[model samples]
Target: MFRNRQEAGRRLAAALASFRKERPVILALPRGGVPVASEVADSLGAPLDLVLVRKIGVPGQPEFAMGAVAEGAPLVTLRNEPVVHALGIADSDFEAVRDRELIEIERRRRAYLGDRPRVDVAGRVAILVDDGIATGMTMRAAGRATALQRPSRVVVAAPVASSEIAADLRREFDKVVCLEECDDLFAIGVHYADFSQVGDEDVRRILSHHATVAG
Candidate 1:
């Protein structure tokens, strides 16, 4: 297995080596996806950007994501009714958590992207890259939001993902590419050796590095 995000990204880049000539755009789902996406972008010589989305977590158990939020056009919210009911999460609680997450999403967009107008996606192939997928809520949100931009194809690429969620996501996107799929995928970190928290500052630093390289 890949040791860390960089190693995983390198392996993933090799798997996707054929895409280089097509010059597809890579949109990373920050703040964790930035590092991995950077490596993919460098390997493929493609421009990198961010697809902003927020996790709509259940109240109290903040890590349990029931859905997600994204800016631009109609916001995408994927509801797992069975999970919500089983978890006893009320509609009010979901709405409250969604509001909070949306606020943070806006702050992230402002802080990380600032004045860098979002690149147009119409007729372009938008590859949504994430470090890994557990609940798949955030990636679903990214896919839905990218749908609004009317991209020719939306590809979901991750180093690892829960098999069930990957199958679910396959129905929504043109292609779902995952390096590893496990049935017992309880957490995204379980598959990584150095699964550290990626901070906003780290994202900013990587973005800056990308900018310098582009310039």
Candidate 2:
């Protein structure tokens, strides 16, 4: 078990030291991953950026992700065709959910990053960090979005993840760096002693700190 995201991030960063030579960029899945990624960025002295991908949840079941939207000049979206077909989800319904998520993504981008341009991952190693992986849907979507940017290598880094999902991530990503693997990851907070809620203000502050440090 980890004491908190900070400690987890530091340990994860140590494991990722080999990638420092690659001059990698740290990409965080915001709201929860910001703090963790911030530590990694500090350790590597790399540019910190947000992935800005929101899950397109199923209608009336907001927790169930049918797809996800990632912000970019041209937005990157990936849908689970099997899930949509199995659930008989209408295209209109899916689009509506995606649009709503896009709005949220824009809000977060403004709130946390402001006018700072997104770090280009093209031909660079891109490491995607999150607090932990539960269902792996969001992270998988994030990987797909990062792939569209043509990164030389795409790596998913986290403190803990389900053993099964960790294996799946290995196949999808160029590399997967997780500190701990558990059979049951229903609640990631269980692995941390202090997994407090990471508010919008916290994200804003972390991003600002990284920007200042970078400058």
Candidate 3:
């Protein structure tokens, strides 16, 4: 596991050095991905921006992702059929929570981005970074959504991932670069030593610094 996100990002940047000349745009999922993406952007001399996706959590157990909301030009929602079937979650129930989370996502986007233009990925490489991958639902949704924006390719980068999900992810993205995959994995937080909750303020600071650096 990484000592922290910085070390993880540095290592990831090394692996992605070949893309430096491509001027690939680094789009990180907010909160957790910010630190890692900053390091990659710094190394690649590319711009960093947030891909604000909200996981529609199951009721009572908010940790279980029922689906995800992909924040995009038209926006997109992908549902987890198995989770819905197993939980017997009705359309009304799912819609209720999805709408609530979207509100929070919008608030965060406004806070971190304001009127700042987002990174243009059309015909350019789009790399999606996250602290780690668990269910891969959000990352999967994010990758597919990014592809629709006409990015030439989509790459999912993470410090670690569960082996089972890693295989499935390979089928979805053009490329997957996970540092390691553990078979006995339980959760993403367990892999990190400094697994602190990255707050909205942290995201805002990262975005501000990224803008200055890119300029």
TM-score of each: 0.94, 0.92, 0.96
1 against 2, candidate with superior lDDT: 2
- Higher-lDDT candidate of 2 and 3: 2
Model 1 misplaced stretches (Cα beyond 4 Å): 212-215
What is candidate 3's TM-score against the reference? 0.96
lDDT of 2 by residue, 37-116 (tens): 99999999898988998988999998887988887657778887888999999999999999999999889878887888
Tell me, by lDDT, which candidate is best. 2
Return whichever of 1 and 3 wins on TM-score. Answer: 3
Candidate 3 Cα misplacement greater than 4 A, ranges: 213-215
Q: What's each prediction's clash count?
A: 0, 0, 0
Evaluated with TM-score, which candidate comes out highest? Answer: 3
Q: What is the C-alpha lDDT of each candidate?
A: 0.84, 0.90, 0.87
Mark the 10 consecutive residues where model 1 has the least summed lDDT: 206-215
Off by over 4 Å in 2: 213-215
Q: Write down the worst ten-residue block by lDDT for model 2.
A: 206-215
RMSD over all Cα atoms, model 2: 1.7
User: What is candidate 3's lDDT per residue for 1-215, written digit by digit as tens?
Assistant: 68888888898888888889988999999889899998999999989987889899999888899999888767888899999999999999999999998898889878998999887889999999998888888898888789888988898988888888888988888888888888866788888888888888988888888887552
Clashing pairs in 1: none
